[model samples]
Target: MKLINKKNKKYIQVFQLFTEEEWTKSAKNYNKNISSFFSGKKYEIFIHTNEETVTYLIGLGKSTMQNFEIQQVAVKFSQIQKEKIQAVPTLVLADFLKEKQFEEFVKGLLLGTYSYPFDKKHSIWNPKFEIHFENLSQKKLDAIGTKSEALVNGQTACQEWLNKPANLKKPDILSSYLKNLAKKYDLKYTVFNRKKCEELGLGAYLSVNQGSAYDAAFTIIEYKTTVKNAKTFGLVGKCVLFDTGGISLKDHNNMHYMKSDMGGATAVIGTLIYAAEMQIPVNIIAILPITDNAISERAFLPSDVITAYNGKTIEVLNTDAEAG
Candidate 1:
């Protein structure tokens, strides 16, 4: 195993591209030979080669070809990182046995490379090579490495977006940042003016914005996918990005963790970016309903019957739950 050291940025850069080719090659070479495992209806481990070290072929099994869910892969990869193997090539095959029953595997394989320098910090470690695939295709393999690289960049941005304190991550600033991403990625987006939201029957979402000093804005984002004639899916996320309970206030200190309230929206936007980058064949109608709640003379109160854009009326039970 090659140990990571002060000047060794190559190891970090090695897993930059998140793609199929990279996953296959790294898995094939993890050590001269490896075993594989696929877990689905049954937990059966099979040996693909007579190679030395144990390589597992894990199949996601049924429903593997459904839309990609990053969280699932993230959890598994995090588990692998915990094992601390100096370097191992891993390949996860999803629904390779059937067509349409396929979904590509995604993971943050390089997450283990991340570490902060502290007085109690541990020594540097070697890089672990890994890749995931739904099926085999030379063209797709060629693109996988680059896709992985882009995911790393996106994840870095997401981490910063998630870490910002609420006050700093206000609606206006959050929308601005998303706009920047849309422009850079060729995504089509439109921000609905507050008045437009009122006209659109987006009352449930708008009610949450009533107490904020800043006006609320609703965003509609569209990312075209590569799957020819694929049906579009709608992703709606609550973009409280930051939440401060309105007049129905809570302990002042309790609001500290509100920045993460918008995680759903962050994930929605993140998916749009990745889908666009990978040219996945699917259409998405993503809605980011943005706002904040702060107590003011103009703040809405409990018992208010606010109607949502979908014509559903929410009887405000507690203003503190405004982001929901």
Candidate 2:
């Protein structure tokens, strides 16, 4: 669903967000019939049929919500209402929230339209969403919608990468995606391949990479903002494409889920992409030490000793503990 600039149009349903305090004070003035059917509990929802339009009362227990919780309430509203209502749902936010909170609400509302990732399968999120806030200018709403949609898109990208099967997320394919993403945003991208990593004395990381036949690398993605005196934040994400646990093999029961071993790196890419697009006045340096810990002729043994990038030595007491 999306926000529409056009107003005065009819909507199938009106979704109203409410906090516990707001609902308590308002419900006291309402008729007994309406008050009995609904309370202002967290995540409580009551659907009422008006003369023509259906109204949905959605509750968020407290007036003060953490930024993420604010987003979650919106997301839950989006999901819960999806089955009952279709296109052009008008969402009445509890208040004319501040800019950041407003943006988060819009972002979470749009995120409701995101479908789970599947290989060779696609789902389109449609149905325009209209915000029914009293004071927000259309131009301001449009700006928030754009940034929120970008963040949602970035989140979906990370989900897609993390959920892909191991065969589909091979090291080369993963690296190529990162390289292209960097180019798209004009960010400085440096990938130290096997030979380069060897020279950098990344023996600990390389030892983990030694298991698989696929090519591996230590990738660094840098995002620089022109904002004067912006601080640089260093981030490291585990990029193990698949973790088979090397010689200390894991149980076969849920091995398929190993595809998501790169979750940390995936999130880093998503966040970096959004920050770059928003020009959020911050420099980000993300390091993704990439590989799959699959068993092969060159897999590291359980008790191997390796030197790390910072001149520290580590004994592989258990190969499965490579990244633990």
Residue 41 C-alpha lDDT in model 2: 65
TM-score per prediction, in order, is 0.59, 0.85
lDDT of 2 by residue, 1-324 (tens): 455444456666676767777887788665668777677666788887757778788776677677777788778876666566655556464563576777777777667655566221211144354565655677887778778867876787888898787888899998899899999998999988888888889888889888778776789999999989989999899889989888888889988888998999989999998988888899999999889998989999966889988998888877873443
Query: What do the candidate models score in CA lDDT, each in turn?
Result: 0.57, 0.77
TM-score, model 1 to reference: 0.59
Candidate 1 residue lDDT tens string, 1-324:
121112221221222212243345445544444323322221222334343433344323233323343334433543454454324444343332332122123323333333332111111123344343425564555555557545645554556667776667788898898898889888898998779988878787677777778888899888876668899999988787656676567677867787787778877877887777777778988998888766777777888887777777778777875434
RMSD of each: 9.9, 3.3
Worst 10 residues of 2 by lDDT: 118-127
Model 1 stretches astray by more than 4 angstroms: 1-109, 113-143, 322-324
Best of the candidates, TM-score: 2
Q: In model 1, what is the error at residue 82, expressed in angstroms?
A: 16
TM-score of 2: 0.85
lDDT of 2 at 121: 21
